[model samples]
Target: MRTTTHAAQAGGEPLDVLIVGAGLSGIGAAATLRRRCPDKRFGILEARSAIGGTWDLFRYPGIRSDSDMYTLGYAFRPWTDPQAIADGPAIRAYVADTAREYGIEPHIRFGHKVTKASWSSAEALWTVTAALAGGGERVLRTRFLYLCSGYYSYDEAYRPRFEGEAAFRGRIVHPQFWPGDLDYGGKRVVVVGSGATAVTLVPAMTERAAHVTMLQRSPSYVVSRPAQDRFARRMQRWLPQGLAYAVARWRLIAESIFLYRLARGRPALVKRHLVAQAQRQAGPGVDAAVHFSPSYKPWDQRVCLVPDGDLFQVLRTGRAEIVTDHIARFTERGILLASGRELEADLVVLATGLSLKVLGGAAIEVDGSPLDPAQAMSYKGMMLGDVPNCAMTFGYTNASWTLKADLTAGYVCRLLSWMDRRGLAIAVPRRDRAVASRPFLGFTSGYVQRASRLLPKQGARKPWQVYQNYVMDLLTIRFGRIDDGVMHFGAKGCLP
Candidate 1:
């Protein structure tokens, strides 16, 4: 790996593209750009010292993928590892490998946190200001800026306020920032939240901790599957590696569709099965309805994926327990439940999800006017209305993030190639006056819902509205024409 000393200023003049965040999206974008435009200069700016964003930051026990590795893995690369549901360290290694494989590691500028990006119409360039890790700032000018920084707020950890929280004497930890020195061994632990993080953490912590109690306000649908993909392994043995990857991808996609359909069409059957599974693990006489039943339909809110029923297995072993209750306050020794019950805990883990922020909290402006993302419409779920030569890649809440990200990257490459062929420097998404739409990301999760007002609107027709289906997105983005009505192409000196 090539490491550069932190310079007071950028080494060269304006670059062709400036990518923010060295995570999966940033590295993926760099690989895509290199393939499409070898003559252009581009660099990646990362805030942290490492490449893996979420995977590296999260170190809590059982920090593994909620989605299968087959779907979660990159489309261009085949994951040869046996474990389909990979852990944090393994996933981080894969990310590092990808960066090294594509020669992206040398181009990445670590400890460079982007603070602001301002667009200059006259220069047709973006002036990006970033704060270095050690304490100083540097500015870079680029022809185009791509934000792959994701939507989560890394610095801001979510911890709900309970009355008398200050009175609690025990140690408190947030899974977002797990401390290495803190010991949970032989101590009673209470994990808050019913999300993927909490579910994963509870089982892992129970092994070391004396006892673990998962506390949740509302129940979430949980499904368990094997850690290894049997079909993926079979295909690898029977066919070529490339063909096996393709088959595995299609098989996973088909399975997702069937499962989603089964949940939606035969709600009772799916619900009964889920309840039975929970009961079988929790044992007879336990009321599975209160802890496992959710108010919303399955897939409405993401169903937590447990590998090989590890969570159920933990419950069966009686090392951990689940409690559905509203927290009234924090006592000196434990949490006071709304039912006037006290749950003692030596340590508390707040896995209460994440706070959503758009474009990694970067300000957006258009023609000297501050752009309101809430008012803008999402053009193909990638670009905002009237935003020129820019695209923001966000993944799916239902499926694997790479599924949408890979498609978006391919589409961006196509757009760049088209612009180069026509000698065009700007391509903006034109706002459709007749299109009546809502926020770009429509979801009820507290974090996503809070930012709904700030997100762009989706279109009613194809290409504009994000079709979560991978096959459809592949065709629309890869095979479709560049001169689609939603996107407006312009020459170097032309406006609009």
Candidate 2:
């Protein structure tokens, strides 16, 4: 990858597009641009030295994708691997390999942490400022700016301050910052949170830890599936790699849509199925009602996936346990629950959750006016209101993230091509004053709720509304009209 900050400074000419964050979405955007908008020059700016964003950063034991790889993998590049639920390092390798295969590495500017981006109405260009590695800075101008920085903040994880935390003698760790040299072997570990991270950790750490307890205020829905996709394996044997992968991808996508639709339309039926599955996994004697049940309906928040019923096996083997209770405080030995029960732990893993951030908390300005994402309404869930020549990719909440990301990239390519052909200098979505606004995300998850007010608003109508459905997005993004009434496209000093 290119270590320099910006291409303009190195060559004295601005790029056609500047992509932020060389993670899954950014890399995919580059590949899409290379294919669809080959005439336009683009550069990717990543803060870290590595290519993988989430996969590379999260180094905790048993870190893996919650979504199956078939759906998570890029549409252009099929994942030929057998594993549906792949680990962090494996996924990281897959992403890095994709970058190399597409020849996207050389256009990526590593160690360029974006601080701010400003757009000029007169020039119809964006001036992006980023910090360099050695302590200097670089400024680059571009006609279009695409942000794929991911939704979560990289600086810190969501760690709630526990009462008497300072008094606790045991080592406290957050999964976001897992220590490499620290050993948890033979130690009693108490992991806080009932989310995906907590479930994954409790089972994996059981092999090395003396005992692992998943301590949470309430239970989350957990379902088990095989790690490998047997159907995908069989398809590969009969069909070509690309064709087999497409079939598996679509099959998984259809199943996801079906399940989510069921959860939304008939909550009681899906809830019963989920609870019954948990009951079978927990076995006869254990009280699944007390330990496995969730208060809210399914799909209100994310459901944790356990591969091959591994978490269930660990629970049955008595290597791990789940404690559903409120944390009273952190005691000298361990955590004290509200039930007056004390659970001792030598090491405490706080897998609480992620801290969400919009645009990585970077400053954005348009025509010397400060811009707030919250004040803007989303157009097609990517471009914000009055945000000229900019688009940000945020993936689906219900399905695989890449499903929406791939669609977003393809649409952006179309937008760029249309602009180039028409000789248009700028494009921005104009939110009608008559339209009503709603929360960007419909979910009631803690992280989302906390950041709701800070996030961009979504309208109730098409082009401005947010739908997590991949099929709808596929048709809309891939074939939607470029001159939609709401989107203003024009040359500088011309009618918009």
Best by TM-score: 2
Looking at candidate 1, the ten consecutive residues that score lowest on lDDT are 1-10
Whole-model Cα lDDT of every candidate shown, in order: 0.82, 0.88
Q: Give the Å shift of residue 117 in candidate 2.
A: 0.4
RMSD in angstroms between candidate 1 and the native structure over all alpha carbons: 2.2
Candidate 1 — what's its lDDT?
0.82
Off by over 4 Å in 2: 1-11, 493-495
lDDT of 2: 0.88
Global Cα RMSD, each model:
2.2, 1.8
Any residue pairs clashing in model 2, and if so which? none
